[model samples]
Target: MCNQARFLAGAIFSLGLVVSGCSSVPYDGTSGMTDSNVRTSIYSTLDSTALVYTNPAAGAPADDNPWRWAGFVMHPIGVGLDYVVNRPLYSISSTFPRATGYTNEDAMLDAYRQR
Candidate 1:
């Protein structure tokens, strides 16, 4: 009975870690996230700037057997989870802004002008 209790607790903890690990939303340090227009504009601009430059398919020329097998197992799981879980979360998150003021453009243009 004690072993069973320990196993149950461990299982619950593992599940919590997995869920919490993936569950995060973008946040910039500002308050008053009540304005819909500001949220929409900020979300749009941030989306444009946050480009995925790294090619997902690009990796080391050779991986060992374990890595190859791990990737084989995890890649499809990631895609499936992304479609079922991440896509909807992303859509919902886009409705909120990452920053309350000063977008990426503002910072970049200002730096350019200074230089």
Candidate 2:
């Protein structure tokens, strides 16, 4: 077929270029990848999820961090309207104890609620 001949010609040309030391990429490009590396990296990361979880700084922190808190605070505030809004279960139980004279959270909330 015509397409087959063109494919063979391209393959032979590539081989010839490599043999003659004519093939190359610029310094800015990847040393191994002929196209993009991101698609490959995405697939590779999905394939190796354990590699991400074991690392603390793997994009998202599993533990409490102020950065994490700030990001979710807005979304939770929005969604929370559903759960606590005008519901019989919604007692005005203070989410945080009143500002304790001490800076401790437990003591503050406890003191706030007059518990």
Candidate 3:
């Protein structure tokens, strides 16, 4: 059934991550994996990290919210790449709404600087 497609999709997504270096920023400030940049990287990183830690099996989904799986699955490797490729002044968390929502885009931008 359709469930298989999602599993396949998750596999493909993970494969894409590995094949494309699913790591971090480009020298020109973009995701070497896709068209993503530090902005996308941070947002995706925090977003995914939240989901996977919150729930790992979901990170390799087979349902309507499959997109939720993307960031979570990518975080482990992506975060490593983030630390390696960038300065990593500090890491923000999802503790306070004063900064922003579930995504860390605003804080990442506010605190963003190159390594």
Candidate 4:
């Protein structure tokens, strides 16, 4: 019974991974930003870890803000998550043809600016 349960769980997880790769949208930054596709959603979620280290006020001088302190405290954690979890997943996903997501930060930023 225990073995059967483990097999069933593995099967379900594998199915989820396979189903997630079915997106027809290309990962050209802009298309992924607009398209409601699984690959883009996953990439966006992972990439959002960058926010913790980024300044809350864009193009402005750093001020004595509490949010800046919070960001300071969280910066190391965000960096670790980006390097360990996010980048690794992005690297793995990019290996599969037609499964490439937003691996380029510059492209993603350009897309966001265009929007």
**Count of residue pairs whose backbone atoms collide, per candidate:** 0, 2, 3, 0
Query: Residue 16 CA error for candidate 2 (Å)?
Result: 0.2
Q: Write the per-residue lDDT of candidate 1 for residues 1-115, one digit (tens) a residue.
A: 9999999999999999877863585656456565442322213234454335544244323342468878888999999999999898877765653544547787689899998
lDDT of 2 by residue, 48-94 (tens): 66665565345342343687767777887867776778442344434
Clashing pairs in 4: none
Q: Any residue pairs clashing in model 2, and if so which?
A: 97-109, 98-112
**Candidate 4 lDDT by residue in tens digits, 63-111:** 5367987998899999999999999887787686355654577567889
Compared with the true structure, all predictions reach lDDT values of 0.65, 0.57, 0.59, 0.68
Whole-structure CA lDDT of model 2:
0.57
Q: For every model shown, what is its TM-score relative to the native structure?
A: 0.30, 0.20, 0.21, 0.31
Q: Please give the ranking of all candidate structures by TM-score, highest first, separated by commas.
A: 4, 1, 3, 2
TM-score for candidate 4, residues paired by index: 0.31
Model 2 segments more than 4 A misplaced: 22-115
TM-score of 1: 0.30
User: What value does the lDDT take at residue 72 in candidate 2?
Assistant: 71
Please report how far candidate 3 places residue 60 from its true position, in Å: 16
